[model samples]
Target chain A: MSQPTTYSLSARIMHWGMAFLLFSMLFAGLAMVQSLQPWHLTLLGLHKSFGVIALIAVIVRLVIRLRTTTPALPDSIPALQKRIAHASHWLLYAAMFAMPLSGYFMQNAAGRPVAVFDLFTLPAIMPVSLPLYGFFREVHALVAWALIALVLVHIAAALHHGLVKRDGVLQSMTGRKK
Target chain B: MSKKTPSALPLRYAIIIGAVGGLGALVFAVAGGLGQSSVTAQDFVNLQEGGNPHLGFRRAHAKGFCVAGEFVSNGSLQPYSIAPQFTATSTPFVGRISIAGGNPTAPDLNAPVRSLALSFGEGSSRWLTAMNTPPVMAVGTPEAFYQQIQALSPDPETGERNPERISAFFAAHPETQTFRNWQAGYTPSSSFASEIYHSINAFYLINENGDRQAVRWAAMPTVSNGETLDAANANALQDEFFARVEAQPVAFDLTFTFANDSDDETNPTVLWPSTRRNMIAGQIVVHQAMPESEGNCNEINFDPLVLPKGMAATADPILRARSAAYAESYRRRAREHFLNSSLQPSPQKESENNQ
Candidate 1:
């Protein structure tokens, strides 16, 4: 069967939406760590809200990805390049899910309820354990850094395909394929 | 016609994604548990030990008097806040009036600032507030304050602070110059009541309508009767304070000033302008005074984090840090007899005749 030329509509929406949310999360997280201003609390709430959104979006995106066929790499692409692309894509997915799950559990371990935009409280799923809280907190931070690095690499790869190689691979996700 | 089974691609992707995600989580859990450990309660204990050789003294404000008082509410505060202490007609309070510095024997003449730490209400509903004479704090964040303390701490071998370290800290944290200037501008008050005590950290006041306002409170003396004493009478402030309060209650107007858009709630080092709207919350009347040993103040931690309903702490790192330091001080003091000895009533010394 011939590979699709572009991602499905649902896939495109989820991809862009997650991109905006994750970017906001990264900046908010950084600001909260550096300063303890009155707005810091507000930013923290937003960060947590975005994290939850990212988690849900990633799950939906994963399901959609499983049902739909991803556009194949151009025939000119090297086998090594294709393998690297496949591995990085999976790693990004792993980081996206890990960041929020770790943060949610970390807060629970610290004996705090996760309030989504102060609209509703998510009950603590785990018992209060300082050690567990420390572990999860570290994991959340470390995964965030890893995710950032992966995102930069992904962006670079896409630019390489679009600008350097003049391949249609980048346009497959962008929905700009002719 | 040959027809292939429905493609197994989706199932294969699902398995691969699940396995990779599970593996990533496992790696993070193990790496994180081994890599980052949160600061423990022991760190605070160690910090205190490193700062002071005198194990029984407080980490700061080592010299103080235990006083009994009542905050008489004018009832005007009811609209702005529902805190019982602010709205009630009157609520009895216990507090310590102390001078800045960790030396219990530090002369009142040389002390840079005075402090008032009070606990209002009784039992479970009690609230604690630690205030100082300065309108703003010396340092903004907990880390900066901690570094300041470390910079000023005496060198183990020299038994005096290294000048280079102190200068480096001051140069790096230029904001602290405001606090230092404020301190240098004032002479030590002859009485704690004569000085204006400010709750340097900003707090949220939730009104009856559920409207929240950011405010910092101050207790201004109603009377200016305290007599200035010279260096020869270095110990006169506390003595005179006790004598005056015993003769008549010393009172202060408890006022709250609302924060404007320009105000920085997190940085206590930044003082809000006086032009901001102010309201008379109540009056704090010190009816009686006693030496630290005779008063119940030693038992109280006076952590600013302890708040009644309608009063909440802001994201001020210094305020949050105080809670932990105060707790550790209270814990260590409670365990040792030497620390509790300061609370034991001592015979009053003969007054020096220096008019």
Candidate 2:
């Protein structure tokens, strides 16, 4: 049994598309809560819309991962490092699901309905509860920081595989494109 | 998959690329939080009265309370502007009255400048304003203001401002003279209810006839307390304000003093002759004021550029600079207060707090 050379085209597109959306959503969430700028209101709208989009995109991404083949690590990498990589990938998937759900719960707890780009509003699943809102707000913020930290580590690993080790671990995603 | 690939880069290029990428990320991170390398808004905030880093209060006018009110138009402004507030219909507004200073605990009597900032309506229809006790603006331009503040900042080691430096700067920027004179005769208002708040920066009012009129506005207290109120209480002004409002609504006559063709609409520090016709725009009645933590105005930015349809910003650089500086100030205060304090001010789009 041989592993594939790179991710499928659909996976690559979803990967980059969701990458931009998630990065922007994080900053928007941070700045909107931290400031009272009206521009932040628009950001709040975009953040909500993009969060929903990312959530849907991640579901598709997970499905794609299950159906299509994925590249395997090189023989040079350690078993422990491989296990860590696999675990971290699962954690990233967990974060993608949690971020938007936590935000939705936070808004609902605060007695505010989550509106997606003003296209339509999501029915509040949780009742208005200040204590619960605080709880979810804290969770949202903590998870965001954790996710960012994880991303930085992931990037560092990719750079190492590509630049230092000169392995195809990164090229599996980049596909040797200029 | 790990396949042995050709060396992606020369060692020198890899090191250079790594160094540049790291530097770029560092710069981006810093810029994202603290703004550009040469930040101006925080600098402006530092020069404000009682300006200092406070845990959960504004960089200026830290001592204040929230207020809810209505702008009841008297129809006098219909000729000057096409704004909805002038059409004789009552409109809701959230406002804040504050003692000018960065220190929230500053004594009320020590406040030479009082401020009133307001936000009428929400979303696209919102009109935000900030006014101060001074009849005219002290600093004409943002450049002059920056230089003046730089001069006013005390020596880091000595902790004493050089009087000669201030004098020289003022001498160089004579446009600040009107405000200087106002400051020399500074007196705390008898009470918040009796204070007059002036919109020093001129704003244009576009009428139905396609006429653009630049005017300054004021919220003149309906009652004159004549400096009879006691100042011994640290929160004397706020105490009296709350007490009076608890009994009956406190009110102000909103008047817009039209600017003459010869007057300098661009310079805020320059005062037009007192003889200019001051037309009553409306009456602002503040029904009540609550502590900032409990008031609706706590989250409001009160950026002056949030004007309604008929009103617009003047070419005055200070007006635009004020909008920018206010945003920076709001960002700092909101971040500090929301993050550091236990109070959860449920984030709302409709809010107001300014100085």
Candidate 3:
């Protein structure tokens, strides 16, 4: 029987950091849609900063994973389950970039300054148009919903790995060994 | 175990580092460098038709024939006031027409006008609030109006006010021709007040029988040439209004032209023909020579929808939508003002440019 190796310190940090960013982005997006009041300006600023950071972190995370050899799953785990895990992880990565990118496109289409949390404006990425904005806005909203759904599944899978499967799948990231 | 490729790893790392640095610099540059003044007319992009679902949905919701708000006639104000022979009610309302721009200096010459119709009035009373630029809007729908306004704002790419885009809007909405006749002369370099016309899409007149009937009103500036004033004749209207009021409190009559049916929504460009015979229900005088005070002018709420008993608005969806949209605009403006106290600060403390 082989024990699972713990995740590296860098990987752990990236995971937690990205989690915080995603959570804040969700809240900021909600507040932006709800109201454009001055109070929300702070949240907007944070959101803008988060998006840029996420864009950077996602690129770094993918690079780091490619450079390091991640431990193989326990032999007891089915091949189907391994494949599922791989697919889900990549999906999460895709979502990280998709949400902010779509949002950027949406702002560009609206022709308003992408005032990220009042901290600064994003460079113009596109020209304003009714039809074009409509297209990007729809994509942005859809991506947001997809991300939220994926997040729910991720939390559920993490719990399942620990509680039902009684496997070290979830514990490896937590630095615990079964 | 296979070793990671040094070539791939460093390249990826470089890209990540470069992107982070670039993005960080951008965020700071945008935040620190762009001041409030940076939000020029160019920042406001013209919203495309049906492009912004939120606005489109709102405009759709606003469409419908609606009326309510009655004005209390002050019997003493004679031509301006309803007589004792007719019963009158007072309902103060607020109305405003704005050109789509972040700043006042943005050219008012060609952009579509957005009218805010908000009147706090009696249950059955409503007002036909409208814009001055477009004589008649496309589709007579609120959503259409909103979409139109969004489209005339700014170019999404360059963030500049584009005349070509506005011309396209005018082309699409041909009904705006009549209003075009009026807005053509309202150049940024010219005095706006002189060329501005007071429009009454609908009105309530207390008939001889003591019952209220619907009406429409308009104030055509009978200029020195009996035509619209050019920018060259600038400040003529402003000078006249101030000088007359200062010399002696002057009164102007707001005559009412009643319409039997309330569906004047389609024909806004056509002034409800006064030849059909409208009684002089009352007149409104500039009773006081009041200078333009920010507090007084900006805060005061006026809606045509506000009316007294015996007076009611006709069935016009555009008018109906105005009630809600106008109120929301003010509500948002008030909130914006509260959050950013520096907005429209005291004239003395702020830049002379604000004046």
Candidate 4:
């Protein structure tokens, strides 16, 4: 097998696309919960629709990540750091899938239909139950905070790799070819 | 893998980085929760609409009719704010006129507080959320307001407010004595058509060249009637307004008043000087009022913080508290509706599965 130095173009595209959508939804959801602006409903609609799109993108991204030849960590990295890096990445994948699914089910438990930009709407699949809705809402909110915290660490690590370590790790998924 | 030299992050510091980030998030969640500790949004929602809220209703202004109208500005506030609502543009809006408290059945003529909540649709400016009160508010902070509500709340056993708590609140805030004097001399308006709605919190209006002017606005009714509404009839107030609107559009001159340099913009308890100049910024002609069943303005939060580009909230703690409390109120009411209208399992689907 050939040892690749960077991620493929398709993986890079998916990474950036999902990153934009994820950040936007997080901030918009925060704003929507805090105020009752006229534009908030529009924000809600976009959040739901983009969440669905993210769900699809994540599935494909996961497949690509698994099938492709991922660049190996540098020999300078310690064994403990490598394990932690691997664990954190898996946690992120789980969170990416969990976020959208919980929100979708929360809406389902509320017995409200999810509309995709007014083009189409999906009907509720679960019976209307307050407990279920509450559970999902809590999960959605908690996961959001966790995801935000994780992203902060992730960004710092990337900066450390690029600037401090002067490693090509940051360029692995940033479209820079070796 | 490449020829370039690589440096590794220390294992000890990597864990610390994530741990610190997690700690930061936890701190934010605790510190930035709603409003002040004593006067949280959760507290307001629980006290007012807690056990069983009226589905699809506001926690405070629970009962109100929706008004559809067009705001016609005279461009008088051009020097203070370039907000579209202050320009000579006619902006369509929907609003509500409500009384104080969570109980929708509260008597209209006997209402201690009359409220006006408006959302300007075409214009980006936030809603003009106000109540019919003196130029200043009764309390300096939202914590005081919440404490006053708590003190006045009827005791479980006695069904009367605790005299000690009431006295303690009054004694602690000597500034509230002015409110008592104002309340003693106040007179109730016979109709919603006559009462003037005052925005208790002050806002800074940003003009061209980034100059800031502190200002307040009120919706002053065009016509006043000495006619007293029927105190016995629960629907009498709404009926009167609806009937009057059918004949002619009830108009209110939307006016903005500039604040003096010495005025205390942060404290709601201190009244602004009467010598401050007033300019008629616009006129709102409410053509018709839709019933609560229509769900027009009934669902709006009227968050005062959702201002246009040119307008900004001052350092008034009450204003910040209002945004948090209002958000909590809207969320609970909307959730109540969502919970009440949950999907039921169909018997037909079960029978079809049996096949």
- TM-score for candidate 1: 0.57
Give each model's whole-structure lDDT.
0.72, 0.74, 0.47, 0.72
DockQ score, prediction 4? 0.09
Segments of candidate 4 deviating more than 4 angstroms: A1-178, B1-38, B50-52, B122-128, B342-355
Candidate 1 vs. truth: CA RMSD? 13.1
DockQ of candidate 1, scored on C-alphas against the true complex (2 decimals) = 0.03
Error of 1 at B194 (Å): 0.9
lDDT per residue for candidate 2 within A54-149, as digits (tens), equals 888999999998999898898889999999999998898888888988888876654444566646667778754444655676777788877876
Would candidate 2 be rated incorrect, acceptable, medium or high by CAPRI criteria?
A: incorrect
Which model is ahead, 2 or 3, in terms of TM-score?
2
Estimated TM-score for each candidate: 0.57, 0.68, 0.41, 0.68
Which runs of model 3 end up more than 4 angstroms from their true locations?
A1-178, B1-139, B156-164, B181-196, B203-212, B220-244, B260-274, B289-295, B340-350, B353-355
Put down candidate 2 lDDT per residue, B1-355, tens digits, no spaces. 3454466456734765575577457534643653332435555775663344665456667777889989999888888888888888899888998877676777777777899998885433458899999988667666676787678867667899899999898888777789988888876667888878998899999888879999999999998774455757777788788888998998999999998899988788888998998898789999978886677676666778767667877877677677556645665555555455564332111132331
Q: Measured against the native two-chain assembly using Cα atoms, what DockQ does each of the candidate structures obtain, in the order listed?
A: 0.03, 0.11, 0.03, 0.09
Q: How would you encode candidate 1's per-residue C-alpha lDDT over B1-355 as one tens digit per residue?
A: 1232357445544554555555455444533432222432235455646755344456567778899989999887778778887766899998898887766666886777789888886422457888898888778876677678778878889998899999899999999977888877866566777888999999998887888889999999887756656667655788888889989998899999999877888789987887999999788999999986677675556767667667777888777656545645544544443224433322132122112
lDDT tens per residue, model 3, B4-110: 55666556555545654554454334334333222211122223222342221122111111112233444432333243323343444332323433333233344
Per-residue lDDT tens digits for candidate 3, residues A154-177, read 766665555445466677676663
Going through the candidates in order, the fraction of native interface contacts each one reproduces equals: 0.02, 0.01, 0.00, 0.02
lDDT of 3 at A107: 53
